[model samples]
Target chain A: MTATNSFFHPAFFYIALAMVLPFIRGRFYYWRWLLLVPSVVAIISVISMDHGTYMVIPWLGHDLILGRVDRLSIVFAHVFAIMSLIGFIYGFHLKEKAHHIAATLYVGGSFGCVFAGDYLTLFVFWELMSMASVFLVWLRRNPVSTRAGFRYFFFHAVGGLLLLAGLLYRYYAVGTFAFTAVDPSNAQFYDYLIMAGFCVNTATIPLHAWLSDAYPEATVAGAVFMCAFTTKTAVYVLARGFSGFYILAVMGTLTAIYGVLYASIENNARRILSYHIISQVGYMVAGIGIGTLMTVNGAVAHAYAHILYKGLLFMGAGCLLYAAGTANLDKLGGLVGRIPLVMIGYMVGAVSISGMPFFNGFISKTMTIAGAAHAHYTWLAIGLEVAAVGTFLSVGIKLPYFAFWSKPIYKGELRPIPINMYIAMGIASGLCILQGVYPNVLYNLLPYPAEAMKYHPYTAWHLVQSFMLLSFTGLGFYFMRTVIAPHPGRNLDFDVLYRLIVNTFAFIICKPLAWMDNIWTNVYRIFGMRGLLGLGTGTKWFDLKGIDLVVDGTAYTVGDIGGVSAKAQTGRLQDYLAWTVIVALCVFAIVWWL
Target chain B: MRNWLGDWLEKTRIKHAKIWMGVFITIMAALVIFNLFIRPHHVEFGYDAYCGFWAVFGLGVCLLMVFVMKKIVQPFLAGPEDSYDSNE
Candidate 1:
């Protein structure tokens, strides 16, 4: 299908659905059926795609490609569609129409980004994703989520501006807006700026604090959607544009290690999972940075797997929040007996995320690690393995152990969990296992050919090695359980710097500016207004006294002259002869004198 | 359904939980030993080919991260849950 001939891009279905959602009134009975839009769109994405651009339109003298359905874009679109369906299913019980609307727009935005063929199209969707997702955070309507949502919006806005600036610069420099891999060797400054923007969204290091700080604060179902789209889309963009950039490898390693280190000490269950997103995304970033065919394939594969398992993890966390009214590990325990199914669902997600055998993470994570090792980046490979251990320790063991297995600290009543949440989790968990057992299900979708990858996750050594690592990590956790116990506290992160900068900006810039504005207001109100008033009074006085007097005096003199002429003309003929004789005598005297 | 599963789980927790942990540890040890007998494929990175390198690395890293984060980083970084509250 050509750009003009194809039906509307799959994203339009979501946009159209979001628009009509508000009008459907009184008890959203049709929501379940309506929620299948993304899945239908996914089917459309598969059947309609012919591995070329569709829905191209000339926008601002540029060809804005809305549907770029190539291998790379299609894989991401497929996962995005699946995740959106799952997210909607998870949030099926929500009566708030706004949640569904925002979610649809957010998911639609992500689809748009994945399929965007040009930078302009990508930027439009990127912003839409950012704007739509913030409502998810704010919909919680608490002071924390509201504040976090603002910060999230501000950060993403800045990222969007950077992307826009870079795109504009690139357009001016190269005169094209095609989103292609940047050549680092001959790259201009705009390319780096664009990469920085991607890095911010990727949640790399200093830019990453938003993920941990905000996601834990999102609504239960909102967090699940938040976890899947933002960072993965960043990975997609990075893989597409900034592949083979050496800086990413170094930064990605640091991000992975840093994220895990923080996840170890975090008290909140959702926050721990949020930190793991960073750590997991780090692996994908590193894979893209390596830029080998295997590594790129691995990165894409990891993104696919990460979305499934991470969404499952968030769903599990959301379940805890729904039932217990809190996700604090310090408050939760002994739920293994109470919510056994949730625990089972959670453990499946936890093990899958920890890269256990016969799980999705096992296949995808190993591909990235093996690719790194194969590329001869030995230290990077080792660093990633160490991060994997930390992943198992914190996410696999600590979070679940404290939330479900530890001694009960919470003495509150537990709420009944919604069935739809379980359905969503079950579906995710099944997919995780399916992808793990049958790697080809995921491998066939990789941008690179499955055969050319030359990697296998089911080998005996691979299984043995992974088992040894995970088991030993479990042993370590068992030994150090007391030391790693959760406490009722928050650990400082890069958000502190963010808060400090914003606060300082308010104090130094905003405060003084406000003070100056006050002074200016006082000057304008008191002095400037008084002066103008006085000047107006003086001008009025001058007009009345000086100019009016002169006019009045002239009028008086004219009246006197008119009175004299009236007296001279009292008698008609006699007066006229006398005046004529007087005039003639005066004229004769003047003539004689001259 | 809940009661039956909970009862079974409670029984398992009381009687067979420690045994399962022991079995898990034994299996890990057996894997380590089995790894020693079987020569793994050597890649460009040779250290990982060692029999129990991953086990040691995983264990050491996990312990170090826990102790360091708990004892050192937590004290400095940890604050009240509402430390960022606007009222404060």
Candidate 2:
């Protein structure tokens, strides 16, 4: 096949269409028809590509491979394409052309990063994702979102720089720019740096605060797109490159536990779900770290499942934010009867995330735990199980109970949500259930051969164990509902460290530097200007007296000598001859003496 | 019909909560009983195969987490929601 036919990268279509969206007049008509064109075309293009590298262009004396149509890239690209469609559906009612353009660019960036076969191409698209997604946060047009968007951009930029440095160093060391797996046992410093960059994007501990900090502050429709990409792309890269790395397994387990612990106390609905994203991605990371065929398959499968349900959850929260104007649980309650469809949709997502039986989470989450056990990582497996219980307690039970079923806290009129939003939620909700019931629907798309995964999620013991665990968790929540109740406050996170560093920077710039500048100005006034004035006066005196005295004295001496000579020369020739003879005698005597 | 369905749903809301709790308790009991009869394919981990082990583990961890988070952790971590907003 020709290069043009075989090498069509999906990202170009969205980017080109995004440029065209601004000029199309008539908001509703334009969006309803043309908004889905890029995603649809991308999906069609993805379906047609065969398994080989395409779009090879020489860049900076190196070959840049833009289309790597392998099984792994294809799986991630598939979900990204479908999720962009869902995102378009959810935000179809928006009249802002800027929002659609930003969303399209963000989606395009994700697709580009996933298909990139070279580190240079991946880094380019990685930054593109970062720059594009920040607009989603800024487009909210609130002071809070504006500030949060800057912080989000700042963190991602730092991550992108780290990746760029690593890629350059690795190129110098290995003499290639190919994106491939780093063997952790034999990795050099550049490999670790690259892994650190990937970890920040994955929202690992201590590097994770940017996610919960910015996601809740994003626009209602924008959060849906933000939820689907970024972290999952990091997971894809981690699974591809850093599998079998032991540190990821340990950190991923800690992230899972820490995420749910914070989600338990968090009051904002979107923030709670944001933390859960960290928790869910932890499973994928740990599974990749385990590095068995089964575990890797589990990780890949989980990412696919997570995108569906997490998008649904965020859409549900967006619905509440759209209708009730606030996502804080302390201020929201008794919304079930008011918006039954949203409640049901939210519950499906809640159950799926909590790993309840007959849901997608049950299928994917169990595989990771089983993989951990099968690999003899007993402590890691146990930690994940505890996190599972905590997950059910906080997100599955507490968040929804307070948001939908608890006593009425909000007394204002709820706004009417658009119908297209409901359709989007319905579509996501159906996928969550469909994949939950039929695991093969998702399993067949795994990078590993289907028969290699010898795990079954539908066994009687597995069902009984999962059900018992979730039920007991529900009972625990029922007993301690008041203790776990949402309050009007924020819980400290790693963002405390982020805030401390930022505040110290501001203090240095604002307070101490200003004080130093003030002192410098005063010193300049007291000594510098006064000293300069004194030097000027002294120079004026010296110029008038010191140099003038020497010149005037010389002139006076010459004038006196001239007057005497003039008097001698004027009288007579005889007097002049006598004077000349006397001068010659004086010169001869001086020469003789010397 | 719609009005009747809405009224019915509203009236049964509290009843639904109660019945849901009962059903949850019963399901827990049934699972604990079923664990006594069924054997897992993998017994490499002994505690996981025990009856009511998961139930106890799940309940214990959840209750401990809630208690520690609310009583111990939140007091240390809790601040006004706008605490960071002032810095911004």
Against the hidden true structure, what lDDT does model 2 obtain?
Answer: 0.82
Q: Please give the TM-score that candidate 2 achieves against the real structure.
A: 0.86
User: Which candidate number has the best TM-score?
Assistant: 1
* Candidate 2 chain A worst ten-residue window by lDDT: A560-569
Tens-digit lDDT string for candidate 1 (A78-144): 8888888889889998888898888889888988898888987898789889879998998998877
After superposition, the stretches of candidate 2 with alpha carbons farther than 4 Å from their true spots are A1-7, A451-453, A502-594, B1-8
**Residue B21 lDDT in candidate 1:** 86
TM-score of chain A of each: 0.85, 0.85
- Candidate 2 residue pairs in backbone clash: none
For candidate 2, write residues A1-594 as lDDT tens digits. 345576468899989888888777773465556888888888787777778878888855678888888889988988888888889999999988898898988898899889888887888788778878988998999877766776686678668767867876787788788999988889999998899899989998878988998999999999999999999999999988899999999999899999999998899999999999998888888888888888888888889889999999999999999999999999998777777778888989999998887888888899888888899988988989988998888779898889888897467788988999989998888888998898887787789856434678999989888988898898889889989988888787886786566555545545554455456445545665665878656655664575545444444333322222323322432343345446534543453354
Q: How does residue A404 of candidate 1 score in lDDT?
A: 77
